[model samples]
Target: MKRYARILAFGAALAATVISSSAAQAETILKASHQFPGGKGDIRDEMVQLIAREVAAAKVGLTIQVFPGSSLFKPNDQWNAVTRGLLDITSFPLDYASGRHPEFSATLMPGLVGNFDRAMRLNDSPFMKNIKSIIEKQGAIVIADAWLSGAFASKKGCITAPDTMKGQVIRAAGPAFEEMLAAAGASIGSMPSSEIYSGMQTGVLDAANTSSASFVSYRLFEQVKCLTAPGENALWFMYEPVLMSKRIFEGLNADQQKAILAAGEKAEAYFNEEVRKGDQLMIDTFKKAGVEVVEMSKADYDAWLAIAKQSAYKNFAAKVPGGEKLIEEALAVK
Candidate 1:
């Protein structure tokens, strides 16, 4: 009996040691990258960081390291990197990859999403479903669905009317917005949001269109004299979501995958709660700096939408397959 007891104890200790070794071997570290500034209240960065924290707390043998402010990948290159498995994850603006996937241009189309509520509603719409389908096909998957509303800031004048953009050198975020601004007679200069400050400071850009959070985060009030903030007739809404490489995601064990997904949900919920405050912060910060802030009137919005239909909308429908259907699906939400 004594001999049998000793043998059983040895077997139990060996099994415990093997399980401990396996658990240690299972820990994984993923790199998460984004273009926004970290540790400075950029909502996009906060989203990524929240994911990191949540996953760490889950104790699921998974850890994420965040690289913000274009530290790891340039803004436009993140989509390509993540989809190719060179990057583990990213907080990315989907339209930035539209050069390779023309259908993604619809995500940033003018007048497609005009307000926070509509932006939220569109997440479940066929338009986004199609967008996500494309993402999956490209070897990445959306972790969080984030829609940011933006506005125009001009050193020349308030950009409330189509004519106001005339002759001004402008930096618009994506191809669709650039097309619309070009049709309005503005000279278009393309650059990432991080460059907007320097572009305006050096006279390379007389105006820019970007998210409200960027205005405050980049201190654009120091560069531009007037801001066209989003109000009742918001015009610019862009989908910027946290994404993971499908290939990398598939490599994770089931527990690690569950932890990552849960972290994403928590991060998304945090964004929805903070985004409105971010917009307000932009408005207040600009006002305190004595920059003129204006909202687009209903009439102004209608005029811009009409121009968009003629230029951006018309071009997209004619160029991209199934583009018209995507627009119809987005509009049908309301």
Candidate 2:
């Protein structure tokens, strides 16, 4: 009878432990938010979903519930929202936080890194280390850094030279882009990507500078008649940050953190692949839409670069704190 009683007690303890573990697993749900629309099917959205799905699959007692399209906070407010623990996770434009850390704005500066590969390497280097520290100081963790390829879409003729941009009102999204447009002799208007089509239709904007992928996602080709052929100019790339709220991250177990980081690294690779492919697709889509795509001459490209070096770089470095160092490091990337 004594032996039987001991056996029963052990069974009960095991059952209780199993139930407790189940409860712990069920309780570990992470809420993630993004400015991109949930149903958009864009690369950013796809990458975020990939992270969520993979993280959950790892079964690290964590699940990520995504709130996309700024459902929880506006695009510009996402960084602070995550930092303040209002959200568990978020992905936002790093340049959008320029107001908080001017060095972050360096991501948007024209002609910083030559191409996506170099840009990605630099982002994972010490250049990003400084920015990461600053972002962490605001109470968030940077998991992934990604970029998009910028292109020129217009309603009129293809823009082949810097001078062609003069007198045209171009819509620019971030600060560096705004400066880039203004320096090129085009009037700049700050507008969200969602409003771009309407802006073009209403004559509020004559041309716009944005990622090739975004041009397709936003369906700007329907309104714009031309796209400077792919690689016509240095594509304006925007740095995207996949961040986690420090409070929530700190609450996670070490195993869960490892799972999340692993998922993030995978997502980063997938995100870059999608961006590169999407950029090419956008260029192809533009050509199919009867849009005139023009390639600028090397001389023209050099001229624009010269203007960017003289005006965009000088002005950006002067205004943004640590901007010079950021530029120096970015350019130094081999």
Candidate 3:
């Protein structure tokens, strides 16, 4: 009977070792989704892969499964998906969630951010701290800050003046931008950037303002006759950071959480470099496709800014919480 008892103890000890081994090898997988495609050398795809690689390098049993091109969730639904725990992470345009979280509207307010350098600086500002608190309250965390400069695509001609928007049905990325166009005399049709192609195809949209990467990725040049491409003089830049669910992030082990954040930092640098490259790529692609590529000049930008302040900025400050102060800090980036 004593021998049998000893044998039973030994069996229990072996089972415990096996269980420990399995636990050590288990991977903590977070599914990351985005509205862009996973293309070869595509910055969005490449950066996501970098994040995955960094987490793996940490050897903390943490990894990310990427669902690019909005396969996991649509662009408009990503924030809701992540916050509700239906999705774990996303490369989200903060402005897209402005409807639900009005404070996010200021992130894409016209004339607030135009250059990558200033956008990076904004990340360290008290304004960003306030934005972070607002987002955290909504159950998400900003993992990476991405400032992707964008441009205007038009069906008939270059969109230079407020009058150029008159009577046109445009797809502006955010409500703030739409308000500016409306105040200038344009009909607004809200849709995610990914749907710009279809909107143009159906003739429902006469113009769109979107990221440089998306301009090329969706081949808007084929549908539109002209593009006000991103460059040294552009006011269409956007803040589309990669975000993770606060619930998921907080539930992670310390090592795993650190790995995720470290990976995000690395990916953000990649984003800045590649987004600039994308701007040039969009210009080349549009020109090569026989689309007239117009650039915003000092005068043109000033005109847009004038209207934006009176319409977009004013509307945002009046509606979104703390938006006026946020705009003050954003414009002070100089």
Model 1, 198-259: lDDT tens per residue?
A: 99999999999999888888889999889998888888988999999999999998888998
Candidate 3 segments exceeding 4 Å error: 1-25
Q: Name the lDDT value of residue 296 in candidate 1.
A: 89
lDDT (Cα, tens digit) per residue for candidate 2, span 19-77: 99987866688888876757767787777898999998987788889888667777878
Number of the candidate with higher TM-score, 2 or 3: 3
Worst 10 residues of 2 by lDDT: 228-237
Runs in model 1 deviating more than 4 A are 1-24
* Residues 180-236, model 3: lDDT tens digits: 888889999988988999999999999999888888888788899989876667788
Each prediction's number of clashing residue pairs: 0, 0, 0
List lDDT for all candidates, in order. Answer: 0.92, 0.79, 0.85
Better-scoring candidate (TM-score), 1 or 2? 1
Ranked candidates, highest TM-score first: 1, 3, 2
Better of 2 and 3 by lDDT: 3
- Candidate 1: residue 180 Cα off by (Å): 0.8
